[model samples]
Target: MHLSVSCGIPLIAPCRSSVKLPPPSPGIFYGRAREIDHIIDLVLHKSPARVAILGPGGIGKTSIALTVLHHPDIQTIYTHRRFFVSCETVTTADGVVLELLTTFGLIHDPQQGILPQQVLLNHLQSLPGGILCLDNLETLWDVETRATEHLLTTLASFSQLTLLVTTRGSRRPMHVAWTRPFLAPIMPLSLDAALQTWDAICEVHNEYSIKLVHAVDCLPLAVTLLANLAESESSKMLWERWEHDKLEVLHTQDSDNRLSNIEFSIELSFRGPKLKDDVQTVQCLSIICMLPQGLHESRISLFADAYSQVLPKFRSSIALLQGLCLVYSSDDGFVRVLSPMRHYIQAHHPLPDHLLSQLANIYCDISLAVH
Candidate 1:
């Protein structure tokens, strides 16, 4: 008797190869349940062409992505075909593609005269389903838009593959959105959620810890860093010092997770042309930081001398700042900076005394008139 294995003409197989995914956070991940649920729905059920976990650095975007990747639903569907590419170190479009291909184990040999792109396509076709997480994508997306677009367009052709990109900026590549892309904007954790995280890190809690956490605006990265420091110092001392010198306290020596430092995290988010090159936006951030949180939108016109003309350029700068996650809008149309960010700007780029005086006078007049 003879036995034979029969298969379809264009043979297919479940993916067995392992890929280098982002390292899971060693600490407990708190908050972000709603985000995780929504993203899982989008990728596993809604079937969007692409999804981006867009937020500022240290907002736990990477941690959230890792959570979704390891979710039981995601794991069952994608079946270990998950891969990750850290776009932070990736400088070019080719570098981005090579990273993805290498993660999927597609590049067997460079001298084989086979294109890595084609290899990726072939492997993707054979897989039942797959998920790719592109972390820190703004490194390339900001400078190499056209090239990034082409790269996304090519990868997005595979309906079975889901691309989950994380970036500090809100803009999506022009190519990937054949349909509406699922955007999960990560905000800072709430006070209660932040307390839960703090509880895990600290053996004690008090007014000082609560105040310090709120002062950092409940940002997970900032909370984690300070909580670690709380191990050695009293929470009151940390809060007092942080209040006295926010940037000095936030500056960390950990080179691996630069986000451990509030200054480093914000600086990382503001890289590339649209942000680093735009002096007006930088100036606007400095001005906004000086005011109380949630400054009225109309008050931005006060920067008459800061711009060539305040209307057009100031508006553009604010929009750019919002896109870069350096600023955000409240429901009342008031814009505000995060606490740590406000602290970062105050330390690094305080407004001129004359401007500060002018702003104070304007506020004084407004308060008097309102009364």
Candidate 2:
């Protein structure tokens, strides 16, 4: 008697070799598993909680949302059905509605002379349960839009789905969104965790105490990118290249999963037309950057000359920037940078000598306030 194993492809008692899969992105990618579990529970419960992963860029807001989607507990809860809209390519609100229509497996010509918002709301209402992860909402839609707010409230209060948002925006309409910690200072990587990250990024092992110190001062994105660079370059070379441009440390795209660490985040925080034509705004903000974090308004007022008549509204503008997640208040009473290392790198750019002297005056005011 002869027994044979039949297969689709010819199998001559073939030697099966294991196919190796690529490693995931580097950096200390530890997540808030407890928070993720809570989010899943919120989605599963009758009353859902809308989470807005709020923080500065490179602080890993999207990373948390993506991780939660893949969590085993979340998979069991959502049954692997979730809608993700990159929203990077989406410029208008109508684009969101179209993305939703496709995600829900509904077929309809977008050009059928029907606007997408109506189609989307109706379709979303029909689904029994779904979760929509809206990444980069600020970049995609107007924060001040009544339509956007209505859409958010409807998704939470009316639809079967929960909306998980990640943005640098404030937690307005408190019922609609909850602020998440992106700073990671509470559970920052231990030296061991950082070393593990280096090993994960490089082909061979390379770990040093000095490198770890630099990483401790770095945002997670920079740390991971550096770890990967260790594969090809000497540590001295990497550090020297990234020296003044500390943000340059975050440029490695090899760790695709770790894109949350992309250096472009620094630029995104700046270069908004919102700041155009506001020289005083620039000087005032730059002065704030120069001063220690969380300086008092009284001290800031001394720099009223920093912005002419505009300085009277410094409080409001600072609040606006803070709400935008470009900055955050500290427990120590200083408005420390939302991403400190990036701030230092950004603030390092050359300023007119006159401006630097003005900034020096602003700095002196803060010291006076301390005294």
Candidate 3:
């Protein structure tokens, strides 16, 4: 379990077990104090477990995990043994294993023809009370299912190590045994959290700020991007521009990271296994985007029938969207599309002329029936 002083990685300290988590994320982090507290209790105070932070992209899953990693309580336990491996760029399970090995300075010989899984398990099992974080795991799991499954299975043996994973989908692959008991689903920031985030960054909270946050579905990424803009642009002007072209306004100018744009982030979720191959699901989402916010399921059925599909078929598509955290059901049974998703669908996947005409006619008929 010990790490040598000459490991060649400056990020690791010369302790028995050295920490190698990502540098703390820049800017104000809000609304996740409770989440951090809960994760700390689960990992440290409770039995060894694998915790999954499930949510839509850009919903701050990674941020919350990082916060928990650096928390005072976690620091006290895993002071020098915390490791973070981002699965965003890794395409295979072997890639993930190597990343972890490199993080811990446990390089294996490629010529030996030995799999990294065995080496990793042996090391982690012997290590004591360390934290291992795997972020954006969907990227690797989707392509390398068997390898990812094997990796998780091996890691499960390390009762002394706590494992954390984040993904955009609600369901973890069943093979991984990431059951409901260890699940932590993250939704958009609450209105208060969103506003507090805005004011914390811009030092101002006004009507326009509220409108801007709500317009973006109270997602933390959008709030931060727009709040950063509020420093220079007037709130009124920022809100107006967001309404006109939100996807562009949400783009971060500071970096070349393609996923920095809120639109890009949501689009990645659309590529989940269920929706990636289903054109009907995408079209249905676009049509749903055209409806008023919180539109009832029955109204959606009418619209779907006008387009020559039955209510059940439409509901199926909605279920797929909901599974991906692209939409949610309100307390009154209305389905609500997240705001960034609404704008993305409207801007990037607009319905054709025939669907648009039928949608309008269906709404008219419903309006008449209601009256």
TM-score of each: 0.88, 0.74, 0.86
Minimum summed lDDT over a 10-residue window in model 2 is located at: 1-10
Q: Which digits, one per residue and each the tens of the lDDT, describe model 3 over residues 212-310?
A: 998887888888888888899999999889777777887776444534677667767666566788877788787778877656876765655676553
Cα lDDT tens digits for candidate 2, 125-153: 55677667887776654433555555566
| Total clashing pairs in model 2 | 5
- How badly does each model clash, as a count of residue pairs? 0, 5, 3
All candidates' lDDT scores? 0.75, 0.55, 0.75
State the TM-score for model 2.
Answer: 0.74
For every candidate structure, what is the RMSD over all alpha carbons to the true structure, in angstroms?
6.1, 11.9, 5.7
Tens digits of per-residue lDDT for model 1 on 290-337? 778666777666554344443347777788888888788877888988
Please report, as a residue range, the 10-residue window in candidate 1 with the lowest summed lDDT.
1-10
Instruction: List candidate 1 segments past 4 Å from native.
Output: 1-18, 178-181, 301-312, 357-361, 364-371
